[model samples]
Target: MSLQDWTEAELGIHGRVLPVMQAPDAVLSAASSPVDPADPETVRLAADLVATMRVSPGCVGLAASQVGVARHVFAVDVSGHPKARTVHGTFVLCNAVVEEATRNEKGREGCMSVPDLTGDVKRASRIAVRGRLPGSGEEVVVETDAFEARALQHEVDHCDGYLFLDRVAGAHAVYARQTYL
Candidate 1:
């Protein structure tokens, strides 16, 4: 099924809001293992990611590693962001990969894990991603632009064990967050 057609309820699980792991945590820097999308545990993790992201203000996406799980799973929802275009609503993907990325642009980005900092990083303004749904394990391809693309790339970076800080041009591009999100 397409990501647009998928929903959290299909997982048949209730998710708990997991604590977001902070940067410098070993798990946040370690690459995640691919998960069996249809596995019960993977489904539950996916749900938990969504739940956690929902409660974190300004969190448009989340990954398993951010929640202290080193697995290639994440949830993303950029529906109402000012820069979002072609949003797919809220959906989880396991073993996601960026198939194509283009139109690089620099933008300020913040993370729940790196709560004290924000950075100006260059990211693709358009992208195409491929992954499997949490419950049914159905493969889906999502093509999007603007903030949705940025959010997908950010979560994908998490799955690969990289943070926004890693993508910044230099120390000059990083700054202390003035306000808490």
Candidate 2:
């Protein structure tokens, strides 16, 4: 099934959103395990990733570790963000690997796990990622640029036990998020 179709189908069954595991959670600092793409639990986790990410404001992606599952899985979509130059509708990946990355640039990034802060972190402006689809065992490659690339890197980092904070240039690179209405 296409990513959108899979998301739509899963949405009905997993309308329940999983809670985001916040910072200071040990899971966030530990490396996650590789997930079997064909497992039924992978499908359930994918659904939860999508559900949780969708409900969170300004959230473009989420990793399995962020939901207390230390597995190499993540969900991402950058379809409508103002900064998004390349749009990938919504999709989940298991055991994702960054095949290529180029053109490093610093960008503003934040995570649901670390909700109080945003940081300037250097990331590739373009990247090629390879992984398997949840429940389908289909190998897929995602080649993207701009915001999508940054989002991909951010989520992949979670699977590797690193947060945007770990990539921040310095203490001065972090900033408190401003609240406004």
Candidate 3:
């Protein structure tokens, strides 16, 4: 099924809100392991990710590593954001990769894991991503632009063991988050 047609409830598992690991945590820097998307544990993890993202304010996406799982799984939902062009509602993907990326633009980004700061990082304004669904393990590709693209790249970077801080041009591009959103 296409990502747009998939729903988290199809997994038949309810997720728990997991504590997001902060920056400097070892798991945040270590690359995640690829998992069998159809595995029972993986499905639960996918649910957990979605639940965690839902509870966190301003969280558009989340990765397993951010929750200290070290697996290549993440959830994203960019609906209602002013910059979101195409939205897929809420979905989780395992072993997601950017199939294509273009139109680089710099934007301010924040993370639940890196709560202390936000950074100005350049990211693709348009992208195509490929990955597997959590329960069915079915492969799907998503093409999107604007903020959703940026959110996808950010979560993929997290699964790859990189944070938005790592993408910043330099210290000058980083700033202390003045207020929590």
TM-score order of candidates, best first?
A: 1, 3, 2
* Per-residue lDDT over 103-177 for candidate 3, one digit per residue giving the tens place of the 0 to 100 score: 999999999888889999999999999999988899989899999999999999999989999999999999999
Worst 10 residues of 1 by lDDT: 5-14
State the lDDT of candidate 1 residue by residue for 1-181, as single tens digits. Answer: 6687566676567789998899899999999999999899998898899888889888899999998999999999997888887889999999999999999999999999999999999999999999999888989999999999999999999999999999999999999999734
Clashes of each: 0, 0, 0
Evaluate residue 155 in candidate 3 and report its C-alpha lDDT on the 0 to 100 scale.
Answer: 93
lDDT of 3 at 111: 90
Candidate 2 per-residue lDDT over residues 40-121, each given as its tens digit: 7888888889888999998999999999999999999888899999887999989999999999999999899999999999
Model 1 bad stretches (over 4 Å): none
* Clashes by residue pair, model 3: none
Identify the runs in model 2 with alpha carbons over 4 angstroms from their true place. 2-5, 8-12
